[model samples]
Target: MSNENVAILMSTYNGEKYLEEQVKSIISQDYTDWHLYIRDDGSTDSTVNLIKKIARDNEKITFLNENKPKNLGVTGSFMDLLANTKAQYYMFSDQDDYWMEDKISATLRKMQASEIDHMPICVHSNLTVVDTNLHGDSLMNSSEEHWSDFKSMLFANCVTGCTMMINQELKNLLDFDKVKSNKLYVHDWWIALVAAAFGKVVYLDRSTILYRQHQGNVIGSNKKTTLFNKNEPFNGRVIRMVKITSDFWQAYGSKLTGQNKNYVKNYASLVQHRNPLWNLRIVLKYPPARATTTGNLVFGSIVVRDYQKLSRLG
Candidate 1:
């Protein structure tokens, strides 16, 4: 591989158990022209010490914010990393996942083969779900390679940060300083939405990382069943969808193109409008924003005030 620089941005809290293994995987990559930039968010455990040990042995691994570490959550920590790091390509890493040896090289190759000059591009691949002990679990299916429509991106976020790689062009365009902590949910979802709107998103069919599923995960793999009661009536997903779209418009409305801005506005109205049935009306009038037919049907069930119907789709 060429000597082009790639930055691996990782956030660690009290991840003493799997942190060392995750860092080792990065060191074992086939492509060696990469720097690991890690930030510890007020970890009182041995996580910081482990990172320091690695840093002492390897010059490429830099521990960020050793003096006065801030207690930003996962999303905030990643946002800080994105703002400060400088690289030709960037990849996000979790404190627990074990990446395949060729993960970086494969993603970089796909990114390079795309038309770099025309638009910013992001490449993400499927992941193999694994248990806490790194035993092989199940394969995660890949979504469609491209999501050009802003409306579809608004309702669902299929992109996982651990499997994502982005060009510097897309990185430069994000206004990280202006990002409101309260409005944003996940850093990867925000990046995916922006990339889908202003750039290109490519999905490689192959699995690139072993996504470890444990009890402490902030967000679990899609294949994992929801921790909540299966028959629960209160629809948190609907509420979250409303908030995410609304927050995105509040944060990035001015940055979006006119067409994308309109799509955001239309989706926002479906959630925020005073009329309770406005969502159903929009679903009937506008083309379906969701990608899957089942997804559209489930969304329509929510719009038509049928929570039981939506739950049955599970």
Candidate 2:
């Protein structure tokens, strides 16, 4: 871990409120062989100035696209950072979250121990959810079963970008063009999907960062949401999944193994085909999106309703 070099990629918009705290936390990290690269997404506030102030004093902290900044959303900004940076290992960071002192060192150690030679590897850990004041709200435990299957990953994302670290092999495999065309939900999910399919996805049980939840976040953790909305319609989600799945197949299907390719095709069919039996068959063949049995059961029950709607249409 001491010999390895890491590049931390962060995307910022109107993050002036918590940006300084986050930057200071990274500077205070116990691991010292890392550089921070931050890209601002056409911020109207003083976010750019704040990041520029930090970069002026530190050689390792780089402010990207300062002269001609483009308003590429959060996903696009991160993708831009990913395309340009090179390092032995890469990490994604949010502009507002404060990391634990040993976060990088701990995750890097885990990656080194579990890494397979010549294969893309990624390691991510649990995060402690906190409020704007940095008060510990709750814990989002990601210590469940390994989510390595393509079918499971197609439906849900278990890895969060702020807590993720990827090796050079994975970095080389990233296709920026495909992500830009596919309208990927986020950079982290795409990376997680690739790691699950092509290499190893390691999950560390310990919480390593203070994940701040606020109104300005692009995505927020929902620890307090109700279990299931029985009346919620699946039509909108199904439509979005169809487009995403088609785009994904067009982009990365050639790199997938025979087994994974078959699973993705079948899963895509289950969503697109109006046949109830195909849905039932797919449900029986592939495990649910969630890893636990009870979680899978609950997931299946909701899908059953959607399949019933398809049956009625047919």
Candidate 3:
């Protein structure tokens, strides 16, 4: 693989503590044919200075939006990075996580094996969950029975951006300008939806990166479950899920296929209908395939019980 074929995009914001370590891990990757693009999202700390110093030493590392720090949030920063860079393959990087040596090579291999001519494809792997000190026994597996289904992806996203490598075809399909930052919940979820709906979402069941869990993490891994938290109130979880689904539908519903469009439309409209029975019927007809059976049951119950309240709030 040529250096120009692979681009790793990292968006940094107040990640001074772990940024250097993470960058070092990338620099030590077994796959050396890759370029690193770092964009600072208005950091108050020495993150920019650190990046500049490192870029000075390494020719492959390039700092983006230097000196001019626009505070595009996480999703916006990543979308901006994606929009600016062109490559045969693109990988997203988080400043806090450490990549395994073979992370790039393994993910690229899987992507190459799964590629189809002119079709958008995204390949992502599981992560080894680690604490701030990079110690952990658990794995953040990125697999669900129905994760590849468009309807399932609308309800829950199993893809993690830091572990993802998307091809040029998938990059072309992700139009950042079409969907505003607010409506798009997260960049990874939006990309997963696009891959599920239009092309292929290939999941590699192996761990590729050290997924660091810390206080400042925008999104963290949960050892118990990825879809829903058992401790949170059922209605609150259902409402949040509904809102995200509605946002996804509002953003890209029109671009989906006829069946998927109706599926998303019905799911997003659950809060609009106050009738519990109607909501129950909809849930029964088009159930979101959650990771676990308990999740599906809880989701169904909450949608039925809180339909009226959800409508009132909306």
Candidate 4:
């Protein structure tokens, strides 16, 4: 450990195309005191070779390629890399994306000062996406204006991975080992749901990177403008969401009790299938709208009548 202020947890799989460039951008950051825990998911290509070369060449870069015999896929590989970091703040990184110079600095500042607990997950920022060489807004930041923004976490995900930075408060609760067992989801949704359950999630209104969107992504960038593509229909979106929310409750059920569990189950339903329970939640609690310092509370308690409502799964 070099007494760094931040550690970047990066996972790669066949990322030779942009791996060198991404590494270059990180190494060029003005904030020099940081460690990068880079791991390859048993890539057969030159990707692993490049990582080895990088580890040999740079002191700040540390490689974690010892994840057993076979590749762990995306989620498992990332989790394996993440479990190896020990920094005051940890930020998730993808193989193809490059971070802005101030990315770590800005997120680390907030993490150190944040009053929230690890139970609520972590805080994240906005992203500016790049399509091929041209750039445009990912339009995720504008999600803050959604009608159901606060109440509709299940309906849509507003958080982006490149923009995430977790504090020690969150770090303590996040058993990186445990996430590998939760079969579904990329790391972003996992963090968002966990954080929102315990407390409010703060969104920094800054674009942290050039979120390169391409067809090669395991889960392509969730940019608003890209919705016109027919392959990216909304039917699968709702189903994938339902699965994600349901899995969250199932995996972390024991950690929650009391109204928190009730709220999570109810809220998850409200989000996954638009179960009328959300509106009912507002009625049962007898408060139309209540505000917490960071997140607002809508207490509607309508029992879910239909459990079989189906949607096209993503």
Candidate lDDT (C-alpha), each: 0.77, 0.76, 0.82, 0.62
Count the clashes in each prediction: 0, 0, 0, 14
Which portions of model 3 miss their true places by more than 4 Å?
1-4, 142-146, 223-226, 231-233, 271-277, 291-297, 304-314
Model 1 per-residue lDDT tens digits across residues 43-136: 9899899888988899999998777689888888888888889999999999999999999999998888884565788888889988999898
How far is 36's C-alpha from truth in model 2 (Å)?
Answer: 0.5
lDDT of 3 by residue, 118-159 (tens): 789988888898899999968866344325777677776778
In the predicted model 1, the residue pairs found to clash are: none
**Model 3: lowest-lDDT 10 consecutive positions:** 222-231
How do all models score by TM-score? 0.86, 0.84, 0.88, 0.74
Error of 1 at 174 (Å): 0.9
lDDT of 4 by residue, 1-314 (tens): 13347888888888888888888878877677888888787777898778888988998898876445357777776666666667767788888877788877776665555654443436687777777563666655575432212335544566776778775556566566555533666666666666666555667667777787887776566644211224555435544555675666666767876755665565355444544655355335532222232222211211233323432221
The residue-level lDDT of candidate 3 at 44 comes to 92
List pairs with backbone clashes in candidate 3: none
Clashes of 3: 0
For this target, which candidate reaches the highest lDDT against the unseen true structure? 3
Candidates in descending TM-score order: 3, 1, 2, 4
TM-score of 3: 0.88
Give the lDDT of residue 224 in candidate 4: 47
